[model samples]
Target: MIIMPQLSPIDVLKRSNAAWLIRDQWRNILEDAYELVFAGINPYTQDKKAPRSMNRQFDSTATASTVRLANRILNEMTPPFDNWADIKAGALLEMTMDKEQIAALDQQLSGVSKLVNILVNSPTAVSARSAAILDTLISGMGVILGIENPEDDVVPITDQAVSQSEVAIEVNARGEIGGIYRKRKIKVREIKDIWPDAVIPSDLLAKLNEKKDPEIEVLEVTYEGGPGSNVAWYYEVLMCAKGQDPHRMVERTYDVSPWTVFRWMVIPGMPYGPGPVLLGLADIRTANKVVEMILQQAAIAMAGMYLVRDDGVLNPDNIRIAAGGMIPVQYTGGNGGASMVPLGTNREFDLGQLILDQLRTAIKKHLYDGTLPPETGSPRSATEWIQRIKDLNQDLGVGIGMMMADVVQYVRRRVEVLIKRGMVPKISVDQLTTKVEINSPLARAQKLSKVQDVINWLQMANAAAPNAVATVANLEKIVAWISSMMGVPPELLYSEEEKKKIQQNIAAITAAQAQQANAPAPSQAS
Candidate 1:
C-alpha cells in the first residue's frame, strides 16, 4: 500500500518540461567532457584525420595517472566498515547487556561486511560494459546506480549475494552542474525488470505488450528544486516516442534515500565533474603534435642534405633518399657549385625539447594540484618517506575529506539497502556513531606518531616508579587503546578473563620453579 500523489496531465507535462529544460541546457558540455575522458578524444582535435598514435599516447598518461590516484585512495584508506551502525552507537560504552549485545551483533556484522566488500571488489559490482566506475569517478564525475540484478528464480537464498548496483552510469551536463539539469535514459524493459510491481497505466502496459519493438523511454532527471528549496528533485518521466506529452512515472523530492543512485565527484562544491587529465588534455595533445612535427622537420633537414650540382637533373623523385645516395640535380650551363645546406637547424630542435618539457610539466602540474603529488625528488630515508606522506596528506586533506563523506555515504546506503533486501540479516544497532577512518599511509603515520607519544609517556612513568607499567591495574586497557590506534582487529585481542587466566598460569609456573631451586639441599640431607 505505497501511496503516491498522482499528477494531473497538465502537472505531469509541466514537470517533464522543467526537467528537459534543465537537461537541454547542460547536455552538450558534460557529454563532451565525458567523451574526452572515456574515449580519450580531445574534442578540439577529434577530427577524423587526427593521429591515432598521438591520441593513444595522451590517453595512456591521463588514464594511468587517474587510475593510480584512485588506487592510492583505495589502498591507503581504511576499508569501509559494515558494522558502522554498531560502531556508531557506542555499543561498547556499557559493561552490561550493551557490551554483550554489541559483541554478538559484531560477529554477524563482520560476516556481512566481508560479503559486501567481496561484492564491491568483484566484477559483478560494476555496471555492464563498464571497465570500472572508479576510473570515470577519478577522471571525471561518475554515477553508480543501484538496480536489482535479478538472477535465476529457483536459486536457494544465501547471505553470499551479489550487489544490486548494475553499472557506473555517466551523466551529461550543459554548463556548470550547479543550477543545471542532469538526465539519462532508462529503457522500458529495464524499468520493468527492476520494478516489476511499479504502478503504471494499464493501457500503456497493454500497448507496450502488443508492440513487437516497443520504443518506450523513461527519462531519469535530477534538477534543482523549486525556488528556495536548496535541493535537487529526482524524477522518472514517461517519454513515449510518439508526440505524446511527457508525464511523471516516478518522482522523489530530495536526495534519493537509501541511495538508489550514488554520485562521485572529482571536485566538490561544483555540480560539474572536473578531472585532472581533462584540464591539461589540450596542451598534451598540442605538445604531442608539436613533437611529431619537430621530428619530421629534423628528418627533412638531415635527409635533405644531398650533394646537388647546378649541372645535375632537377627530378627530386629520381634521387633515392638514402645514405651514400647520388642525386642528379638540374645542370647549370656555366660554373657548377656543390655545397651542403641544411633545411632545419639543431638550434630549433633544442627549442623544441624545451617546449616539450614545458608541455609535460603542464600535464604533471594539473595532476599534482591535490589529486596526486608530483615526482619532485626521491626521499632518502624512512623518516623522509613518512614526512613526504604527511605532506601529501596535508595537500590532499580537503579533497579527501569531501570525497570521504560521499564514499562513506554510498557504502552506508548500500549496507542499509542490503539489510532491507534480506541479503544481510538485520542487527540491533543502538545509538552508535560510526565513522570511516582512513588508514592511508599518511593517516597511518599520523596514528603511529600518536601511539609513540603514548609509549613515551609510559616509559617516563615506568622510570619514575619501578614496575609502574606492570603495576597498572588497567594495563590491558592501555594495550587495547594502542592496538586500536594501530588499526588491529578487535577479534585478535584477548578478553580480560583470558588475560587473567594467562597471568595466573605464568605466576604458578614461576612459583614452582622458585620452590624447586630453594629445596635443592633436601635430597642431600635425606
Candidate 2:
C-alpha cells in the first residue's frame, strides 16, 4: 500500500528526465558494453549532435560469444512451438478439484498455453526477445514493451524492443522493478496517430501548420499503482515543448504492465543488474586493444624499416621495400653499400598470441560459451556424473530461476491481455487459482539433477532395508511426479482408484490359486 507522492505533470516529467541523468553515472560501463560487445546497441548517452558509426569491433571473440549465448538462451528458454511450459492448478486449488475436473482444466489451460506460445513465438516477439536477450547479455538488462494487435485474431500480440539507453527503472522494496521511465524523440506529425487525445501546444501546432515535421522529445512512464488502486500499474505519456512545462498526452491503467524489465543478474537494492558483459569487459577491452596492436605490428613488419649511416651512401627516400625492388647506392668498404643495414625487426608474436589466447578464453568463460578440453583421466563414475549435473545446476540455477520468473510473468500477463481483448475465453486468472510450470530445456535440466538425487536416495534406502524405501517415499506418487517432470503425458498414468482396484483383483486371484493348489494335493493322495 505504498503511495506515490502526488506530483504535477511538470514534476513527473522532470523526474523522468532526472532518472536519465541519474542513470548516466553508469555511462562509462554501459558504453563499454555497447562499444566492445554490441556496437549496434545504443550507449548510455549518445552524441545526438554528431553522426555515429557501429561495429567498430577490433576483436570478434566477445562479439561472437555474445551472439552465440543470446541464441542459446532463446533456443533453450523459449524455443518456438516446443510446449516448454504449461498452466495448471495451484496447490491450494488442486485439492478442491476432482480428477475429471482437473483433467478438463488441463485441457482448457493447454489450449490457452498453446495460444500464448504462439504469441511469444511470433515474428515480432522473437525479434524483440532476441534483441532484449542480446542487450541483457551485453548491458545487464533488456526491456520489451508488449502491444496488442487488434486486427489479427490468431496472433494478436506484437512486441516493440526498448533500448536500455532510453529506459530508466526503479525497484520496489521487494526487489522487483516497479517503474520504468523511457524517453525518445518523436516526430510532430506522428503525435496524433500515437496519442489521439494529445493536446498539442500552440507553438508546436503553429510549426506543424508550416509543414515542418520537427522531432521533439517525449517521455513515457509506467509505474506501480498508488494506494487503493486496483490495476498493476499506471501508464502516462508526457511531453515538454521547447521553453514550456511538460504536459501529459495519454493517461491510463493496465491489468498488467506492458513493459517488462528483465535482467541477467540482480544486485539487491539496485534497479538494474549486471550482465556477463560487465564480467568480461576488461578482457574484451584488453583483447580488442591487443588485436589492434597486433594489426599495427603486422603493418609495421610488412613495411620494413632500415637505417642508412650518415655516410650518405644509401638514399633513404629512394628505398622501395616491395618485391624485387632495388635502390642504387654509393659503394663503401667494398660492400655494395652494405651500410644500409636493416634495423632489427622481430616478427615473433608468441607473447602477443599467448596473451590473446588467454584473453579469448577468459571472454568465453565469462560468457558461458567455452568448451572443455578432452578428458585424459579415467572415465567418469556414476557418482561423478551425478555431481557434474549437480554442479552445473548450481552454477546456472540462479540465472535460470530468475528467467523462469520473467517467463511466468510474461505468459500470465500476455494471457490476461488476451482475455481482456476477448481473444481468449472469459476466465478469471489469479495467482491463487493457477500456477505456471516451466519445462524449458535449461529449466528441466535443473530439475533433472534433483530427480536423480531423489532416485539415488530411494536406492540407498532399499539397499539398507527391504520395504524401508516405502516409509521414506511414496513410490507411486514419485513415479507420477517423475513422469510429469520428464514430459510424460497424463493420459498414460493410472489413477489411485484404478491402481487399488487392480491390486485387489491380483490379491483375489493369488488366493484362489493357493486354495486350488492346496486342495489338489489332498485329492491326489485320496
TM-score of each: 0.63, 0.81
What lDDT is reached at residue 193 by model 1?
A: 61
Q: Which portions of model 1 miss their true places by more than 4 Å? A: 1-60, 78-104, 126-140, 150-182, 185-191, 198-216, 221-237, 240-242, 248-270, 278-289, 292-347, 369-392, 427-449, 452-475, 506-526
| Candidate 2 local lDDT, 229-316, one digit each (tens) | 6666888888766786677777877777888677878776566667888878899989988888787677657765565554554465
How high is the CA lDDT of each candidate model? 0.48, 0.74
lDDT tens readout by residue for model 1, 44-88: 333524633333242344455555555555544433222221122
Off by over 4 Å in 2: 1-7, 40-56, 95-104, 192-206, 306-343, 371-393, 425-430, 466-473, 495-526
Question: Which stretch of 10 consecutive residues in model 2 shows the poorest summed lDDT?
Answer: 323-332
Best by TM-score: 2
For model 2, state the Cα shift of residue 221 in Å: 1.0
Model 1 residue 282 lDDT score: 78
